[model samples]
Target: MMDVGRHPNIKLLAYSEIESISGYIGNFHVRVRKKARYVDETQCTACGECAKVCPVAVPDEYQLGLSLRKAIYIPFAQAVPSAYLIDMKACLGTNPIACGKCAEKCDKKCINYDMQDEIIEFDAGVVIVATGMDVYDPTELEEYGYTRYENVITSMEFERLISAGGPSDGHFIRPSDKRRPKTVGFIQCVGSRSERRGKPYCSNICCMNTVKDTLLLKDHYPDVEAKVFYIDIRAFGKGFEDLFKRSKEAGVQYIRGIPGEIIEDPVTKNLKVMVEDTTTNRISEHELDMIVLSVGVTPRADMPEVQQLLTLSKTPDGFFMEAHPKLKPVDAPTSGVFFAGCAEAPKDVKDSVTQASAAASRAMTVLSAGKIKLEAITSVINPEICRFCTICAQACPYKAIKVEPKKKSIELIEAMCKGCGTCGAECRFGAIKMRHFTDEQTYAQIDAYLEEDPYNKIIVFACNWCSYAGADTCGGARLQYPPSARLIRTMCSGRVDEDWVLYAFRKGAPIVVVSGCHFVDCHYIDANRWTQKRVEKLWDKLEKLGIRPDRLFLEWISAAEGQRFAKTMIDIERHRQRVTKEEIEYTMKVLSEQK
Candidate 1:
């Protein structure tokens, strides 16, 4: 961090936040708001003179509030710029200029009470998101008595107490009495893998972190008893299993059960924990001098704002979703944007470093190229035929289409397009065309499928990334389904133009199904949202025409759901068999009348 701050080419803007981001991949313009520090970075030195005379003091956030710091202080020991800064919220010099003792004491005269926030702007070719994660607060679980018991602390607080710069000055002590604890209890998964109170996903590092903590405790005091209570220890990483073994050999007890309750002793300030041993089917109670909650990680509280700024997608767990989990883990779905560290998911230091390197390499590749190469398969609009209703623009998840309502014109920016074909499907006037998956080509595929047995055939339009891949997975699994369900692939479910569905229905098709990725998990951000709207519109039209709305089905299918694909196919075929010849003829007559 210090090296990056001093690097000639790198302009490290500390204490700044991005206000807005605009433009495309290679031409991104960003506006930033830099908060005032009340101390000039270039003029101020790393002397602690100002902090010594400051009257105001507050909880140090870097130490998780385990220690107190002066109002005018650096965030941490090795903070970049290595300069003293005032916290306006904690200082008395703000608004009324109540206290100027720090300014008087400062030999360099770097303090400035009149400093204001500065707005800065810059252009970049690529952007990397490395906003780290936050630890889950376990105070919500009242059963653990985390708030009531003074000795019950989180893993982070434990780190601060043990550090040389901590309030304890490198001496491990109980928060209640500042005495070295003879027995300590480490509770794993305090805020992880619990559908009731916490998230469903594993915290990825809690198990190994507990192991390290136990080893560290035993090393400091050989006679001290250390115990870890967990549902199960997942030491799957390299050398992680060995570390767990070492902790056990070093006299750390491993218990396979999460404590159900904790009660503190008023006299001794110790905690009595109750837990059921699943292995022996017996309940046990243990008393310990101190308890440590091995808290899990959570996505940053401001993740939604960051995701919106970059037009990025997020997983159901609230972490930023990668472009592709396997192929493009570091890349965001939006071009020229990449992810690193726990911003993407709950990852350990090793994995975060790996992803950071990958993201940096990807950014380097994008910036090194003088010009970007856009995909040939992008949206094209015919202005003469366009209604300029802005439906295409609204449907585009990437905001690739610009609407000029006054001129009745629509412009498609090919550079920003991912070729999801959402705009093409939403364009009711048939003015927008998806380059490769044009209406003519799609209609031909539909016509070819219905040529043999139109009334018995079940036509399916499957999205290329999800539903089509699901079919391939079904085939690989050798899952058997009725042959009547014929699939036609498109770049996205939004690519399934209503014309293609009407043409199939007019040819006496018994059923037409359109499938894509789940609403939240769309490969092209919210492309599946447009798919839902289009399908709903088609259902409304079919009902008005006196055709059965049930005949047109819209299903959400992902690549991992092979069984769902096969089951859906079988269900569609069964429904096709129940459709009578007269109903098919009626549907065909109604669809044909519309033309």
Candidate 2:
């Protein structure tokens, strides 16, 4: 942190928050709110004079509310800029009559309660999201007795208790009695891997953290007894198993079960832990001087706001979703943004460092290039034919389109567009045109595919990223399917215009199968959603036209689903075989008669 503060190229805006984010990938504009510290950072020498005179005291959040701090004090000992900041909320008031003891004591006279927050704006080429995670609160897990019993504390509190600069000054003591604990019990998964009250996903750091804590406790006081209650000791990291073995060698007891309940002895402030010993298949009760609930980590509370500002997407677990989990692990779906640390997932120190470095490299690559290379397959609009309806703008997932109602113009930002053809498909006035995939080209492919054996043929509309790749995977695996199916590839299932399906059916094709990436896993960030809706409309149109809606199949295929793709093709062939020649003729006649 000190290095970052001192770096000439780095401009660290400490105690500031992002207000809004705007513009494209290489040209991002940012607005920030620099909250008032009520102290001149350049003048304050971080001396103890002002803090000593301050009358107001509040629970120190840095110490997890285990200690008290004055209103005018540094956040921590090693804080950057080496300055004091007043907590306006904790201070008596900004008015002159309330309190001014700290200001009077300051030799540099940096304290100023009249100071106000400042807003700053800047521009950047790229951005990286490294908003770290917060630990889960154990208060909601009432069974753990976190708040009920003073002897029962969280692992974070335990950390502060053992730290050299902590309130207890490295003395590992129970909160109730302030005495060094002889028998300490650690409970694992307090707010992790439980569908009942906590997160269902595994909180990656809890197990190894407990292992290190046990070693620390046993090392500090050799005679002290440390017991760990857990579902499993996840010693999967490099040298982790060896460290786990060393902890056991140091006389740390490992119990394979989480305690069901904790009962506190009112007189002695000791805790009685009730748990079924899974290894022995018997219930047991253990008495402990102190209990530490190893809590899990969760996404920060402001994740949704961050997503809205950057136009980013998130996984179901609330972590930022990468563009592609395998190919672009650190890259955000937003063009110039990337992710690092626990903001992406619950990762350990080693993985977080690795991802942070990767994100830095990605940002550097774009910065060095000085220019963004847009793909050739981007969407364009014909201003003459456009209705300025803004449907294309509203339907765009990337927010790449701009609308000017007064000017009667719709502008497409080619650099921002991913060319999913969703806007083109949604444009009823035939104004939008995709670069590579156009209406004329798509019609040509359909006519060519159904030229021979039109009745016996199965016309399949496959997406370029997933379903087409799925077909290739099926063929690569040598999966046996009927040869009568002819596939027409589009950038996305959204690119498959409703007219294309009708045209294929009008050409006497027996069946049409439209497939794309799964809805949640769309390559173009939910472009396949429009595909699903368009298919539903086609189903209705077919039904109303005296045609079997079953003749049109909608399947969600992924790049990895080779077997499933093969099965879909085989099913479509079966349906094609069942379609009579008379039925095909009638369908062609009906489609041809429509407009």
Candidate 3:
């Protein structure tokens, strides 16, 4: 932390929060709130004088409330900047002449009760999000008796109690009696893999952390008994299994089952644990001096704020969703933004460092050239055809389009545009044109395909990233599909303009299938979502125009689902067979009349 503070290129804004974020990848505008610390960071030498004179005291959050600290105190011992920050909530305002003892005693005269929060605005080429994580609170479990019992504590509190700099001064003692615990019981997966109470996902660090804690116990107090109860140990990391073995060799009893109930003695405060030892195949009870709940980590409570600010997506586990799970692990769907540390998932120290370095490297690669190279496949707008309704801008997934109200024009940043063609698809006026995949080119393909056996053929629009690749996978595997299926490849499902689908129907097509990547796995952020919306509107249009809505099909196919692709094509062939020549003619007549 000290080294980072002194680094030449690193400007450490120690106590700052991101207030707002705007603009796209290369030119991002950021507003940060540098919270008032009261003491000037450059002037204060982190002397203990201010803390000594301060009357207001509060529980130190760093120690998990195991110790008390004055209102005017450093956040932690190894905190960067090494400056004291006054808690405005705890410190009575000096304007009303409340407690002003700390301000007077400050030899550096850096105390300023009137200090206000400063908003700093800056532009950056890239940004990294390492918002970190929060630990699960086991108090709500109630059965663990966390708040109900004095001897029961979470794993974090246990760390502080065992630390040399802790309030207990390196004495590992029970909270109830303040005596060294002879027998300690560690409960694993306290707030993880529980469908009813907590998150159902496995916390990556819990099992290994418990093992290390047990090793620490045996090292410090050789005679101290340490018992761990868990479903199973996960030591998949390099040398992690060896550490688990060492802990077991040091006499850490690893049980197979979790405790069903923990009952504390009313007088001694020793916990009575009732658990089924799977290995022994018998229910047993054990008395322990202290109970430690090996708590799990969770996404930060303020994660939704970051998600909203960046317009980023999240996975089922609530972590920030990467661009691609396997290919672009550290990259955000919103380009230029990268995730590191616990912000992505519950990772250990080593894994977090690895991801942080990777994110930094990715950011550096983007800014190294000083100029962004845009893709040839981008959207173009016709000023003459544009009605300035702003529908295209509203439908754009990337927010790449800029609409000028006074100028009555739309400006698109080519570098920012991902070439998804969602804006073009949503433009009712036909003002926008996707550069390479223009309306004329797509229409020409549809016309040529429908020119021969339009009634017997099935028209399929596939996204390049997934569905198109799935079709190629079918070909590579020699999987059988209907010979009548004519595929139209687009950059994204969003590129399948409604005009093409209608034109195919107007030419007497039997079946039109719109297939793309699964809703969550779109290559162009949320471009597939625009595809979904457009398909729904087209379905309504078809239904109102006396055409069967079922004739317009929507499917989400991934690159790995080649078998499903072939099967879907067969099903489309079967559906096509059901449509008679008369029905096709009627559909074509209805669509042509509507057009």
In TM-score terms, which candidate is top? 1
Q: Which scores better on TM-score, 1 or 3?
A: 1
Which ten contiguous residues of candidate 2 have the minimum total lDDT?
Answer: 90-99
Worst 10 residues of 3 by lDDT: 90-99
| Residue pairs in candidate 2 whose N, alpha carbon or C atoms collide under 3 angstroms | none
* Arranged by TM-score, best first: 1, 3, 2
Model 2, C-alpha of 114: deviation from truth (Å) = 2.2
lDDT of 1 by residue, 105-175 (tens): 99999999889999999999999999999899888999998878999999988888888887788899998
Provide TM-scores for the models. 0.97, 0.94, 0.95
Residue pairs clashing, model 3: none
lDDT of 3 by residue, 1-595 (tens): 8889999998889899999999988889999999999989899998879999888889998888988989999988999999999998888758675778988899889999888999999998898999998999988898888889999898899999999988788989988888999999999999999899978889899989888899999999999999999999999999999999999999999988899878999999899998998999988888999989999989999999999788787777777888888888999888789999988889999999999999999999998977777878999988888888888888777778888757997888786788999999988898899998999998999899989778888899999999999999999999999899999999999999998899999998989999999977788867888888889999999889878888889999999889999999998788888888887889888877777
Backbone clashes counted, model 3 = 0
Q: Distance (Å) between predicted and true CA of 419, model 1?
A: 0.4
In model 2, which regions exceed 4 Å deviation?
94-97, 572-583
Task: Give the lDDT of residue 362 in candidate 3.
Answer: 92
lDDT of 2 at 189: 87
